[model samples]
Target: MPVEWVIDQIKAPDQSGAFSYASGAAPFCEIRLWPNRSLPARGFVFFIAATAVMLALPLIAVLGSPVWWGLLPFILGTLALTWFLLRKSYRDGAMEERLKLWSDRIEVTRIEPNQPETSWSANPYWLRLALHPNAGPVENYITLRGEDREIELGAFLSPDERTDLYNALESRLIAVQARK
Candidate 1:
């Protein structure tokens, strides 16, 4: 079934907050948040270029002699390594969305292949949202944390969008916290 209570309006700035019930059909059922971060185009281009270079090495090495065919192993190895690195980088750039209820335990899914799942709960009265920033050499990610668990969001958002989302989340969190 469609979500019984859809979030129509979200407050800004705070990393965490509450969603108002648009239909009023049910008491607050669940809270959902998505943080996004975008992959650097330059990084992707670099990966592609590296892969192409690796794929061409065998042909290049074969130009001189029959023994040059031995370079096939090196080319295959390079291709495999490149694929692994690219997959890991893409997974790192993926955004994670979370849903939970204050009245019960929460479960967080990483949304990335081979990642572990998390579960936790917050004090019903003092539920708060938090943002954990990651400053990696190649990229950045924003993690959204609630009472017990957190998920990374904004992994695919542009810089401006990330800022806007952070603001929106911050404001919403403040408003919710002020309610009780």
Candidate 2:
């Protein structure tokens, strides 16, 4: 799970011993979400090195022959292409979603590589969180609707994670609404 609760203060009390629920502009909860990455930087380096070694193993037999020279360029090219494609995949996966829940409002911001950033915000009172199990592009799709606008949330998350996120969001929203 790549979801991180950056700031969780939904139940924090103020100096007066009251829930800080709509007392200020500060958000009660803030969360950041990103797609799970299996290959980290260290793993990537190791993988590339291992690939180079494996790809070079066949060259040992032809080391003193002209065949090695002929195969060297092709092997290097293949390795280069593999590295390039993996790097591109890493770049394409560079995206993040941030959700901030304030006393009176909820806001979501999406940051994607090589694309314009997008944001949405609305009053929590009028907001609704929806989870679609089978009718969406992905299973357990989650969306937030408010202020005459609707936005998808955690679309990159797995089905189970999306369901968990929906549950968490629903409960948190309910708690905030209760204070209103």
Top of the candidates by lDDT: 2
Predicted candidate 2 versus true structure: per-residue lDDT over 1-180, tens digit per residue: 989999877563344214343565557789999988999999999999999999999999999999999999999999999999999989988999999987577889999999999999999879989999998999998989999998999999999999999998888888777776
**What is candidate 1's CA lDDT for residue 150?**
54
Give the number of the best model, judged by TM-score.
Answer: 2
Which TM-score value belongs to model 2?
0.90
Candidate 1, 101-128: lDDT as tens digits: 3222233333444666544444434544
| Over 4 Å off, model 2 | 10-24
Compute each candidate's TM-score over C-alphas: 0.47, 0.90
- Worst window of 10 by summed lDDT in candidate 2: 12-21
Q: How big is the positional error of residue 7 in model 1, measured in Å on the Cα after superposition?
A: 3.3
Task: Record all residue pairs in model 2 with backbone atoms less than 3 Å apart, i.e. clashing.
Answer: none
Q: lDDT values of the candidates?
A: 0.49, 0.87
- Over 4 Å off in model 1, which ranges? 1-8, 11-50, 53-64, 91-95, 99-112, 123-125, 128-166, 178-180
